[model samples]
Target: MVINENLKNEIEERERLERLYQNLVEKMPAVSYVMNLEKEFSFTFVSPQIQVLTGWDPKDWIDIEDFRLKCIHPEDVHEFVEALKRSIKNHEPFHHEYRLIHRNGDVVWVEDFASPLLNGNNMVESYQGVILDITNRKKAEAELIYNAYHDVLTGLVNRAYLVERLNQILSRRHPFSEQPLFSLLFMDLDRFKIINDSLGHRIGDQLLIEAAHRLQNNLFPTSTLARFGGDEFVILVEGEDPRRDAVQLADQILLDFQSPFLLDGKTLFTTISLGLVIDNGEYTEPDEVLRDADIAMYRAKARGRACYEVFSKPLLDQVINRHQIEALLRDALKRNEFNLYYQPIVALKDGRVVGFEALIRWITPQHGLIQPSEFISLAEETGLIHQIDRWVMHEACRQVQQWYQYGLSSFPFTVSVNLSGSLLHQGNVVQMISEILAETGISPQSLKIELTESVFLETSPSVNQQIQNIRDLGIQLQIDDFGTGYSSLSYLQRFPITAIKIDRSFISRIDAQYSGTEIVQAIITLAKELGLEIIAEGIETVSQLHWLKEAGCDYGQGYLLYRPMDAESTEKLLRNIGKGDEVM
Candidate 1:
């Protein structure tokens, strides 16, 4: 009887331990499961978490006619079953992620892992594993991928994705008539900087978002638009005839900009320039393709903004030449390879030499006597103009001081230096000029700063104040190329301008049959009325000079009077003038 009681206690203890194991399985986060592999994955045991995963009770899952069919997503069921069969047959472990349909029709993502169970003889008996809800992790992964490929500001595909897609299209194209064609439209918004600076970055950001959305709606079905950052965008298109398609698409984008962008209760008008390149399917280089489009876009900007240009070899050559010249110019500045040629300005009445305009010359070792037209604009664009302008100012002032040593320091017998718009806006520009003049010991009255009408475009307080600061230094301020741009009367009334140079265009038209005579005469009359001096530029013929003289112009400078010469020749000419000898 004692042995029988001891046996009963042992059986009770064993049952208690089994219940403890079952309790732990039911409370676990993941579903602990066991399947009878003999009956085609028939479930012999399941944790309570299975109900949380599939919305089915464990007992109900056991009675279900087809539990796999009910819980597994239909599309993934076949693959899951095949992999399960292989694992069970080979006694291998398997891991997979797939959708599970809940009783409430919600699709849940799960990480399902299963391993074949073995008996004492090392033969497969059943399968057991767990299902983890990786739905949150999957969503996080998907979102990560989306963010990686898209731009943060514009929501367009970023440059990386665009390049990837471009290379793919390039690699897949056929070699002949059966091959497809693709084009890249590289473009940027013109005058965006003006708006961005005048307003704020907030307004600029809104404008970009709106513009991107508008451009997106106008793209071809097989095209991708990408934001290349900060006013620049690129489009990739595929078609039977990509060149023609590119034109149409670019036109549509340009047309979209015609309608003003309404941003934060402000209507802003802007235009874009486009560069197009058609792929012949012979290359798969992304950089080359992008570079070609960029080159074309710049050409469009050069020809004038608000237009598009197709890629050509000449454009590429021009870009390459420009880059090489830019590098050379930087070197030229450092090597002191630049020289100044003086062009004499003469009084119209007495044929007396008044002053000389300083002209820059780049005597490049590779290319002799590089003219300003070839590299001045490039310098301005490259932010190297400020340094070049400063050097020119210093040289001109020093030359005038040297002229003083020769007793040539009078009112109009000074040196005139051209000022770039960028230089004028540079910080403490007036201070810099004052320091240069103080250092060179050139009389402020003997140095005149010549500016174009672009200086008068904005009467902003800063611009006006800067102009006033320079004027306060007792240096002469004159407007250069007056008639070619906005000849605003406000310029005389607003700034400290003392003279106006009639543009070479208007001076070239000065004749007995001059069509622009009224314009020039009116400008002269306006200058005289404002108590400002007038100078006529580019007087090539005797008739043009005679007309300018007869028109009561104060001064004239051109080939008719005296061509630009070297400093030594200018000194000789000045000596003759001091001797009262006729220069004309």
Candidate 2:
């Protein structure tokens, strides 16, 4: 009786333990699996959760031969098999992540882990493992990768990818590869900023997307296309003959943008400038390729956009020169290397000096006597023009004050200073000029503001308002280097323009052929009709002066009348003029 009770109790306890194990296996999220290695790699036991995880019943794993292999992604099968074998051979634990084709044909990623079940000899026995669904994690990883390499707006490869791929190509090429050359075309869309400023960014984004599609469509299958951010794109063209291909590709790109883009009903027209560099196997860094291509792109833009330029040493030299100028210009004021020279603006009727134009000159310790033509543009680009403009205005005013203090104020001659177009954008421009005149104790009439015709073409209402404020302040407004720009006579009617300085280009072309004579006559006629003054620049010859006088030109200035001189020389000339004597 005692023995029977013991056996019955033991059997019940075993049954309860078995039920607990089954419950654990069924409740777990992962599919628990056991394999028999002595025989073929086959499943001996699999959790019922296999159905929930991979849509396969537990029985299917055991009944079907090589069921896992059949479901394993083809690309990962070898790695999966090798991992299991390695774990069993070494009698150690193992882990791997690989792909599996689900019963519904959707790709599923699984994190597989296995523990080798070895005998006393530590030889092959079997592997017990679990596979947890990691498809969501894999999807997250892929999304991160895509975002890292591609632009979100256009769905094109971004600059990061361009740098990576460019470096890869350059690394694989060696002397034995004969050149293994490629071409990089750097493209920048012209007038894109205007579009962004005029239309909304939403429309601009749409235009960019369409432009990207156009560029990607034109590339060869082997090539790579990437966006360098902000209306700039770079292409890597791979071919045995990359030079010819680059030219053809650039030409095609120009043609592509030639047609207007219709975006949400508005037809917008735009053009692109291309800078191309045919790789000669000399570059080791990716940025060098990009830098050279960028240099060329600017050259294309300089030649007027909708054109292409190939990388050259001279372009690099020009870029270096620009950098030097920018660096020097930034420190020019601080070092007191800047000086002002005055060129007299003469009245054609009596050759009497009516006013003087302040021309800035930089006398650098390293590079002597740098003219405005060499560095003024750089100053404007670097925002140094405002500082320089303020200095010239104050200095000219002070010099005029000095002339008055020294009895050299000849009939209250006015001093004209050219204002950079950038300054007109300043909301405080009128106030700034007002403060400068007030601080110097100079009358506004003695200080004239000179601007290029390009200034009148500015569409800014604020700028026009600013000009009106200057005129209201009793300061004279004149257009310097006129006839070279595209402003119309209507500007004279619109702005408070007191005079127009005809560009030297028109004056220099006067000859027996009467070149530019008609243009001059037209300008003089337009000025006369509007009751505006006209001053001819670059009057190097008597014939030019004679012709200008005959054409009713009111004022002139150049090497012929008076070269740009220092303040002392100009004061002397002013005294001479005060005495009713012409210096010439």
Candidate 3:
């Protein structure tokens, strides 16, 4: 039949719209479907995505009854069916998530949204729905949740998770009623970092994992052990008699560590220090209790490790004091609280001043004055000695430069500054010295670095090489308090030593004690043979100085000639010496 032009155009328009809708459905990534309301969930239409999403062909599902509902996970089927019922009966849209079993036998998370399709009479006729695969998103969310409470390296509950567990236990009014009187013990390995550094980190990691496993196996059956980070572990025990139990456990732990751990064909020995606290009647916050345990652990280390200690108030107080001092020291370098005092080194033959040793003194405004013995050791303990050493070098260099400007002295003389073992062992010691020299414009020959015996013992070959390299830069190396140490004559032959200072212990009794005189003589003879200059220290009397001069000591320093004085006093004393005052 021939149709009117207007009717023909309308038919073509409707056909074009239907083709567009089909193309959109076929190309969509999500599965789309329509079902009727006769309890017959036939796929009246299905997108091509259905095959990829569910491994089922569109034609296969075309006449299938309730195929989608059958595919829903057994666990989520009730929820899914109830939502579908509400959507159909109330004529409202519904959204839900369920696990879908695909034809490949794999379960996946899928989000479904459906709306009740209505006839022109406003009555529900069918349902149209879309399904989105959200398996990857669900997996990602699960991982994030898991990682939030677990340590990634060890796969153990982290500190945050531990705190949460503690809170859960504490929130209960009867935690100790049947759960057994619980206790938490913190464990730290002694000198663990030395193992990490001397050996590589790989070995250190293996050692830590082995330690964790040992703790797990040997600990009480109900105990939970966790890695608290490098070399630290926490053990939670649920039992009675916690005090005696903790000590016994610590002893067993030490015994287990006594056996050599064979790793990469090497036998390594390790020990641990433990801090334990019983959760008897006293109530304490988790963090506060952990802090007290940490303090006790340090006390264990101080008392010669491989032991355990219970928390005490006095130990915590000491920890607080140490922290306060450390905090103050961090700013002390910037506050200009430190100064250098010079003790003159004199030529015994002519009684003329040759050089000086720069000693550090702290001038705290609040504390009045602090001795080097007090803060210097503290600095070493807190790893602040490197900064303090650098400051001393700069100040000593500046003072020598000042003396040069004064022209009181004809030429720049060696001003010795002490070097801490920590500074010497650092890999960048040579580079630091070179940089400081370049920055200060001080002649390297005029600066002397005094090292003690412990410095040599702690330093590696790389460090020893660095020391030799710096010495080659024209700076002198002097071993201070030489006779006091395992003072070996062999180091003189091995090291490029320029000078040695006889310890005051030998010098103070040179004339009174025969053995002291023999030690002084032997040291002087050795210094001459080794071509190393000798300086006798702590010559407090004229008789001692006379004896030292008779012993052919090249230089001597003591309270007899001059005590350590400020730069101004040192300059004045030197000026007096230039004028030949009180020289016999």
Question: What's the residue-level lDDT of 352 in candidate 3?
Answer: 73
Clashing pairs in 3: none
TM accuracy, model 2:
0.89
Model 3 earns a TM-score of 0.60
| TM-score (all chains, Cα) for each model | 0.89, 0.89, 0.60
lDDT of each: 0.85, 0.86, 0.80
- Per-residue accuracy of model 1 over 368-397 as CA lDDT, tens digit each: 777898899899889998899999999988
The local lDDT score (0 to 100) that residue 199 gets in candidate 2 is 74
Q: Report the Cα lDDT for candidate 1.
A: 0.85
Measured by C-alpha RMSD in angstroms, how accurate is candidate 1? 3.2
Stretches of candidate 3 off by over 4 Å are: 2-27, 35-51, 55-70, 78-91, 117-126, 146-152, 157-160, 163-253, 256-290, 304-308, 327-378, 389-419, 425-461, 467-584
- Please provide, for model 3 over 1-584, each residue's C-alpha lDDT reduced to its tens digit, 9 standing for 90 to 100: 35688899999999999999989888888888887777466678778898888788888778677876787789998988888778767889879888988899898899988788899989888878898999999999989989988776677777777777767656663745634356778998876766677677999888887887888777887566777788888887765565666677888998898888888998887888888877644554678767777778877876768888888777878777777777777889899888899998888998777788999888776676777765776788788999999989988888887777777665346789998867766788888888878877778988999999656644456667888897899999998998775566667888788999999988888664333588889989988998999998898977788888888899989898888999999888767666667343
At residue 165, give the lDDT of candidate 2: 91
Looking at model 1, residue 48 earns an lDDT score of: 89
User: On lDDT, who's better, 1 or 3?
Assistant: 1
